[model samples]
Target: MVKKYRNFKEVGDAVVIYSDNYINDIEGEKLEDLCASYMERGFTSIVIDFSETDLVNSIGVSILIGIIEKVRDCKARIAFSGLKRVNYDIFSIVGLTKHIEIFDTEEDAVNGRVPQEMVTS
Candidate 1:
């Protein structure tokens, strides 16, 4: 099933991408395209708010890896907020947490309030 997502919004220096209930194969490509567009537009900081999302499949994880590659190439920063425990574990197991920061709230991500130890170069 296709997952729903909101339009990307600018929040200070970061752009926020809000995903819906689930992220699977169908939603992966769309997310990849959206993130590519943002990168093309010179957006260096991004926050993906998963407050409404609880599940993600392998395809979704792959898409996120693509975004992380782009972010690293641009020497940019990307963070995730409001991730459920399971989703958080998935990200960690995939080693995404090493490349991107995770926050308890969208506000913390947008405000660059993440702990120094959690911040990646």
Candidate 2:
């Protein structure tokens, strides 16, 4: 069984996961597990919200890459939101932006990628 992360909310076919202040090895693993569990649960969209995240180390970046690949292989859409300027630049430099969407807010991320059929007026 996968260990679920508590700081997340479900919207239609999307799930918004809030990141901790720092995304190091442990936190990154937890985030990966959470995202994987959500994918298994059949969510079509997954957004990782970095509103509170202050930093992401190299280990975290490596794990994020794995998570991104898993999400893609599962045919799911993934997005990142609320990233700080530095984090944004880091992600861009690392080519993560090439694989996923980036949004300014959790709502924007969720609304932008959730399966259209799952949306309501």
Candidate 3:
């Protein structure tokens, strides 16, 4: 299915990327741009809302991985929120859950406790 790409919002230190469509390589580029722009603007922490997105392809996963690496370079972090069981499984299988944090809600993502690695770094 060709889903229409939706826009994203920047809230405080979080950039919420919400869309029902799947995010592939092309869309991943857009996400990368947003992350870079936010970092350039001095925002470090980010919460990517996947509540509306049901699926993410390999390319999308690569972009997310890239986000993790980029955030590490900036000594920052990215939180994934509202992921379904299957999506969560994907993250776990890829060992991304250890690298990036996940939360049940946006509030939890922003206000919830962070991992020690994230805090110490």
Compute the lDDT for candidate 3: 0.76
Scored against the true structure, residue 101 in model 1 reaches a CA lDDT of 77
Give a tens-digit lDDT track for model 2, residues 1-121.
Answer: 2224479888878888998999999999999999999899999888899999999888889998898888878878888999999898889889887657788998899888454432321
lDDT of 1 by residue, 1-121 (tens): 2223456677545688887678887677777777778778887777888888889888899888887777767766788899999999999899887767788987788777555653454
Estimate, for each residue in 1-121, the C-alpha lDDT of model 3 and write its tens digit. Answer: 1222356666666566654467788777887888888788787777787887778888889888998788778877688888988888888888888777889886687666668887566
State the C-alpha lDDT per candidate.
0.78, 0.85, 0.76
lDDT, candidate 3, at 71: 74
CA displacement after TM-score superposition, residue 51 of candidate 3 (Å): 0.5
Best by lDDT: 2
Quick one: best TM-score, which candidate? 2
Better of 1 and 3 by lDDT: 1
All candidates in order of lDDT, best leading: 2, 1, 3
Against the true structure, candidate 1 reaches a TM-score of 0.82
- Candidate order (TM-score): 2, 3, 1
Tell me how far the alpha carbon of residue 67 in candidate 2 is from the true structure, in angstroms, after superposition. 0.7
True-vs-predicted CA distance for residue 28, candidate 2, Å: 0.3
* Residue runs of model 2 more than 4 Å from their true location after superposition: 1-6, 113-121
Residue pair clashes in candidate 1: none
